[model samples]
Target: MQHKYLPLIIAAALSAMSAGANASGYRFGSQSVSAQGTADSNAAEANDATTIFYNPAGMSRLDGMQISAGATMVVPHSTFTDSGSTRFTHTPTGGTAASDYVPSQVTAPSFYLSKKLNDKWTVGMGMFVPYGTKITYGNTWTGRYALSDVKLESVTLNPSASFKLNEQHAFGFGIDAEFMKANLGQAVDVPGSVMALAGTPNAAALAKQIAQLGGNPALLGTAKDAHGANDGKDWGWGFNLGYLYTLDQNTRFGLTYRSSISHQLRGSTVWDFSKVTTDPIVNGVLQAASHKANSAALVALRTPETLSANVFHQFDAKWAGMADVTFVRHNRLGDLDIQFPGTAEGAEVIRQQWKNTVRVSLGGNYVYNDNLTLRAGLAYDESPVKNAELTHPALPDSDRMQYSFGANWKLNARSSIDLAYSFLDFKDAQINYTNACNPLATACTGNGETTRGTFKTHLSLIGLAYNYKF
Candidate 1:
């Protein structure tokens, strides 16, 4: 029965592996093409239904039913160069010869709809991806023992309502239902230390068979180069609150807050020994041992909360300016703990020690004419990970600068098309990681290994959207 579903599982995993996110800390920013053009500073300038994401209270600003749909193409380029790496046995001493470690492109899509329930009320709904990540390294790379691939994907459904106290004040609240999944893969080395136990009681025959199968008898018990995979999925719930204040016809301010969410993911781990050796006798023994080590795991993950303030000012009908300040409580993600049920391995904890971060953006729009609007913006985003030691291959986050430009073309009084482009430059990052072997494991033991390298990344986003008012 499990074999029948193996292919489907693998396919789903691969699909998840191809998704990626934007902004710092795996948060995406292309939910609205209109906002993407202005470097995501549209919270207070709620001119469309997309405000359902940035500030739901802005929904009260819309006069009628509105629908907005868009997609963003995210193109990321990451390169890693080997500084120096050492395996447990100190046999391999450098990183992979291949330079590119991340995929070149991916896409994220979003949809939003808003309706004015009455003169003092508005309702809205939206679907989008808020957090995701994907990274793939050469399978035989020097760091393969530590990590080879990692994927994290999440989607959120939001339903919201806003109440207008008067012409100047509006309050909004919403519920978030989010689904997330994660997959990780790595290689396990077969070390000589394990092979040394060949003459021992339970290992004698297995060791002899491995030696006869062309495996170095000298490295009898070590991880003979097996593969390990972990995959899981979960659902979490949260809420958001927003307030909008219109100082006058020409100026307005918006504040929004999104609550944090916690997820307990259920998953399983599989260790494939067939990849380690080809001998039938040795394969049978190792396969059985690998299956014995397989166990179900429960992992806990938390997404951060965020607070944002936005300002919009209209100097004239032809010129308007906007600014935004956003703070993310990333410190909540202290660590990731995975517990194996019915296994003696107990649990494994990876410390994150992340810090709260802030992002600032400034933008302006120009009414080129009655039918065209041009937008430009600049932003600086901080990373939650403090340094290289805290950085993981799955999310190699860094402080970044963004420059964006966009345009909105009005096809008629009730329809328009939006286009935006953004360029992101991430500061170079350093990685220094080490994994120690477990002496209690009977399969392999040779101390551990260290991987040191430099990572460089940059990304470009192109977004397109169509908006309609009824």
Candidate 2:
């Protein structure tokens, strides 16, 4: 194969990767241990350096210098049970079985540092992962032609400053430098491709030539699968702002907004046709056809913006309450457009049609004594994915309920340790999608084979942190 054909092969692979899934559009909720303890209602409490992420304005309330470091272990399980799925040719493909497709565990970590520079000003910095996930299915699964493996990872560096404008108000601002990497893999249906190609005028002549070359024409159109993979990385920038108002020393309100960032990912894709057939002529024709359809692809992706508001009230020195409501602009992710520069094929647009979502949380903290504090919280999070038809295997997301509990152990006047645990229960979802085999069809239902199935997921998270002041 010529070197120029390599880009085309890779482009096709990248297209498959772009369709993989992300939970709640790839939002991670474990930015702070204290926040997680209260189901992320700490936006107005701002009791530690982690305010750099929740509500930067809270930094103005900190005295001296403080540092907080933590990590959250996320363990998730997802299983898929097929209902009655088949290949495009209406052949049974064994999609009506049960399998586990999600990774067992992943970790999200965070670190923050804040310094009171003056009587009314504070500065802070943080490092964290806001979006990430991994999903994999068996190679022989019925949906192998649609998806097999996908992984997305990201990290952000944030620097922020807060100003105490008066006794009642404070404001904060920050800049975000984020980096992301993605990988995807899927099986390619070679036999299906050959059958589809048979519609061309030259197919008959090609078949004759293959027969003369001692090739079996019947085998050319038989079911066979290949493999394709792609990986890409990019960097993006955005900003966040926050405001805090104090009704009294015991009561406060907070609001924060994080802007969206856009990325143009650069990557390579590769295809393996070894499993297609051993016939050189057949393989050559397939490779040439694929090369003509592929190109060096550039994919554009965007991270959604977020808005959150919270209230923190101190009932007394020993007891306090907090509540929060957060909005995610997931609708910003409408579709992924993959472009092959200088090619007439234009861009491959994959429809996502995601919807915006919200999260609501309620919690309380009780200071048992100078040495210990206990916390508990509950939350409801909406999924951006609307229905089963649009749900992809890479991200079988659903609405979720989260229950959390935590504690703070005071080591000294200026030091403490925080621990928290949360259980996330996701509603079971059903998927009934088919890869469109007919080019003129408006939906997958009538144009191709259907992969009908059900998905179930559950997640557990444990967080630990050490906080200190100087």
Alpha-carbon RMSD, candidate 2: 4.8
**Residues 101-191 of candidate 1: C-alpha lDDT, one tens digit per residue:** 6667778889999999899999999998787667778577767666677766668999999999999999999999988777777665554
- Superposed on all Cα atoms, the candidates' RMSDs to the truth, in angstroms, are 4.8, 4.8
- Model 2: weakest 10-residue lDDT segment is 1-10
Task: For candidate 2, report its TM-score.
Answer: 0.88
Error of 1 at 290 (Å): 6.9
Model 2 whole-model lDDT (C-alpha atoms): 0.73
Candidate 2 ranges beyond 4 A from true positions:
1-23, 95-98, 195-203, 209-218, 221-223, 292-295, 342-346, 436-449
Estimate, for each residue in 1-470, the C-alpha lDDT of model 2 and write its tens digit: 11111112221211111122222556676689988898887789999999999999999999999999999888776677777766666666553243656656677789999999997899999998877766677677877655666677778899999999998999999999988777767666555556655777656866776788677666677636666667777788999999999999999999999998877777666667656777766665555545433345467667778899999999998899999998988777665555555444334344456788898999999999889999999998888777877665655677888899999999999899999999888889777766543322222111244567887877788899999999
